[model samples]
Target: MRIVIAGGHGQIALRLERLLAGRGDEVAGIIRKAEQGGDLREVGAEPVVLDLESASVEEVAERLRGADAAVFAAGAGPGSGVTRKDTVDKGAAVLFADAAVRAGVRRFVIVSSMGADPEHRGDEVFDVYLRAKGEADAYVRAQDALDWTILRPGALTDDPGTGLVRLEAHTGRGSVPRDDVAAVLAELVDTPATTGLTLELISGSTPVSVAVRSVAGN
Candidate 1:
């Protein structure tokens, strides 16, 4: 399958690229930095320079041409102000979906935060982040023509992947490694049953690959 990943230089995006490329899938990543292009090429992925904040839907769709699916994995990153959080985290996600619709891309997978649900998220300094994620999640779900899946993960860690993961409709107080999260994203792309579903994930006793397969009763 051909896959397009936004924010391709990120740690999670790199992990996903490696897994998909290893499986012989055609992977293209949109990165902001020119240097990141070399890194993507080293991992067997074609890299395109696309800035989400400034790119138009038509432009993004053009960049995404020939891809079977698009994964929205971009973020504003820590230390970015609240406004940037909304622009990158929420606006960019929405823009990508719009581009997907315009381009007639049927499959989309999004990496979202676990506490995006207002009922589940408590008031805190990160509330802005949560709300932005929540809004983006809802936007994806509202598109009927698009086959979309949102994966909500808890606090992110940078530790080496344990591979094991837990998957459910809702994982309260969950935490997951970034690598594990990438693995799940790869699985979901190929798992038809994962489409149209919103899932929450975290570390578990079973490998992430196994956990992802189990979500669809495989």
Candidate 2:
């Protein structure tokens, strides 16, 4: 399979590149900086430097040529303000979906936050971030042209691979290793049943491969 990963330099994105490439798939990573491209190349991914924050939908679609799927894993990261959170997270996500539609790629997997439900709007201190992610999720779900699956993982941690992951709709609050979440994303890419579903995943007692296979129903 040919896959395009946005935010190629991200920890989870790098891990995903390793997993997908190891499976002998054609993988490309879209990054916003040249440094990120070099890092992606080290992990066997063809990197394309394109800033999602300012690129047009057509421009992104042009970069997505020949991709079987695209995964939106981009974020504003630390030191970013509330404005950046909206632009990079929400705006970029919409751009990706639009690009996917134009490129005729039906499969898209987006890494979202656990509490980004549109119905949960409140005056929380992190309201900006929450609303940003929430809007992106709603846009993807409402689009009929794309086969999209939104994976909402909880507070991300840097723990080593635990293999086991819990997958379900609206799974309660919990944190999961970033590695495990990547495992889920990569597996769901190859699992068609995961399409159009919003899954909330966290660590469980099973291995990552096992959990993915269970979700794959094979």
Off by over 4 Å in 2: 122-125, 213-218
Candidate 1 residue-wise lDDT, 1-218, digit = tens: 99999989988898899999999999999999888899999988999998999999999999777889999999998888778778988999999999998888889999988878533365454788888888899999999978999999878999888888888897777688898998899999998777888999888888776887777778
Candidate 2, residues 92-136, lDDT tens digits: the string is 999999999999999999998988865656664367777888899
The list of candidate 1 runs beyond 4 A from truth reads 118-125
Candidate 2 lDDT: 0.86
Best by lDDT: 1
Q: Record all residue pairs in model 1 with backbone atoms less than 3 Å apart, i.e. clashing.
A: 163-208
Cα lDDT, model 1, residue 81? 78
